[model samples]
Target: MSTYLTILGFNSAIPTVKSAPTAQFLEMEERCFLIDCGEGTQVQLRKAKAKFSKINHIFISHLHGDHVFGLPGLISSFRLLGRETPLNVYGPKGIKAMMEAIFKYTETYQGFEVIFHELSSKNSEKIFEDNRVEVYTIPLDHRIYCNGYLFKEKPKERHLNMKEISKYPEIEICDYHNLKRGKDFILKDGYVLKNEVLTTAAEPPVSYAFCSDTRYLESIVPIIKNVDLLYHEATFLHDLKEMAEYTGHTTALEAAKIARKAKAKKLILGHFSNRYADYQVFLNEACEIFPETYLPQQLEPVKI
Candidate 1:
């Protein structure tokens, strides 16, 4: 299964001509998920070549405008596109009411079903799961109730060794699934062949964590530890550390420290404040602490 992340918008509360707001597209095993529907998210999605109709789930981190201002427009666009599939949206408690108010005033009747899952947990909890992936909420420290999302690929079945299986003509193709499931194969003569001889171990599962618009909270380190890719908010440079804390945001250095403590494989900095024109400074500061830090460009896919 292929897994990757596409950054749609990365700016903080303010939107600029060069950048939008906080939105990301997570593609795992061909299923698409929208992390945050910031302003111009639909436009960014198109720019990124992400099919809008393919995204069935949208996860909002908080009730802030920069994070969810684009939702009504996105959902309205989906209706215009003749989307009939039920859309599942997960967010904080007031999301449903907010959407309802927008729809009522705009008289936008959704042709498709919109299901809302309200989140209010203060601890890490599994919120969504399917055969391919499982999503958990990472409780974050923000001025308002906030949560990040953790995407983890499910364990895959063992790979069948063709060469080993070819040695036994008696073993039929129907038994391949059993062998992959680590079950022994019984021959016609009642002889048993162990599964270990026929298959090899599957590759380890991959995980991605998305954290943004929150203060430097060490409590989340254990929840996101050892993720393949960690996208944390770096709203300000080290010099503005005090301002970052006051605004419930994190500086680049603080983001790097969290990544290092969690032992993340790679750290991707985002949610930049508009004060800084050049984002290289954020990368430079973060890389000093966590060498495997990255800064994503708009519409570029980062493979995990």
Candidate 2:
């Protein structure tokens, strides 16, 4: 079965006693992907009951402090926990330099190797791919060179038929593996069994996208279209539309609009501005346009 995505933190530039900045944890297939490690991300992850040791890849959307200020501590914690697995970090330029400076000044020694893959362009394209999933960079309009990430799981193999296997019990059980591989079964008598007779297609893999700290940019619609779950930044309410545009952020309604245009199955709104004491307005505003819209609070994990 496929795993669900979780939200770790969902506040804006200012971290309040009630909420923190942008940070998310995607739990899929026994692996964890940390997206935008904002300040106090470690604490939020612990609160969400996410295993930090399971995180092998970290994706940073931008160089803004609100997006990636917890790198030093997170890396240090890994070393302290005696982690030997290599960590692959994908982010925009300047991240490598920032990490290097942190390690050099703090004299922190890591038990694992840290690999940095920096993104340097605005074009929407694949940044990483493996047997498990593929990640794409979604260009956005921000004050800095920012990009979102889209994660799509690889398709599963076909299921096998146990009833058909019962008749061929005398035959090698290894042939069952072939059925799962979508191959036809052949008997010693030269008779062939079609794949459709012994197997069925498994469920299709799902996809999720994370878009934070960006303005109302419609160009990203194509990149995030039809995603199973989408988490976009909504730093202000509709009443603060001017503030959102001036600061290169987005309002709750604007985030919902993008989710609706992209035809995403679910929309999670976060990265709220500190000006709002309560998130009721944000929640009400977002759901008004998109009924599936949801507001993620700090350390509150919402299954996708």
Candidate 3:
């Protein structure tokens, strides 16, 4: 199955009537990942009809309130619901202390275990991995310590060609697993059948990169090179690039440039400022450099 990404909120620092702050839901290989828990994320998840219990991992980009203000409330809800599985949260160095302080003031003990994996490395590093997917941190240039995340699906098994396998009656159903694993089949007489003849090549692995609340930095291009889908923050227009640099945010034009340099297949421009009412302006600006650019549709899932 393909990966799907849902944008829960896509506004800038403020939550407007039309949009909220930065938050996203990524589903890869049946695993749920929440990227940034902005305010009202729980409500947004309900609106999206997401499977809340499957969200065992959350990735926070920075300490900004707009990016992380909704975490305490979500955990509290989990506690009330009696979640027994452990939840892993990955973020900057002080994330553990911040969450602990919040929990200390509110409810003391939680029924479920909340594991906080604090990160302080300025360079890119592998932070999460399972049998199906792996995640890496992309060091970002922002006002404070921040990071973007890259999610990549692991290599898949080759497809079984039943038509070819039917030629040999010796190949039983129990041997199909080996064929899908790209292993050759051998008969009792020692005649070997090549794996390429019995199975087709597997599809290329899919990858996604999330770049939130960062200035125009070229260093991240190499880390997210050739990403299947890229979601980068575009908080301003090109005319206000100076202000964007001062505030540690990227303009739509600069975001497109980064996508072009990284050779991303699809680029998504989000985290829009409230001043801009029309999203077409952001689309027009980014499409000039990258044609596959898209705007965020609230709670709508995009297949990657």
- Residue 18, model 2, lDDT: 76
In lDDT terms, how accurate is model 3?
A: 0.94
TM-scores for every predicted model: 0.96, 0.92, 0.97
* Model 1 per-residue lDDT tens digits across residues 56-164: 9999999999999999999999999899999999999999999999999999999999999999989999999998899999999999999999999988789998998
User: Which candidate has the top score in TM-score?
Assistant: 3
Clashing pairs in 1: none
Where is model 3 more than 4 Å wrong at Cα? Answer: none
As a whole number from 0 to 100, the lDDT of residue 57 in candidate 3 is 97
Whole-model lDDT for model 1 versus the true structure?
Answer: 0.93
Top candidate by lDDT? 3
Candidate 1, poorest ten consecutive residues by summed lDDT: 175-184
C-alpha lDDT score of every prediction, in listed order = 0.93, 0.85, 0.94
Rank list by lDDT: 3, 1, 2
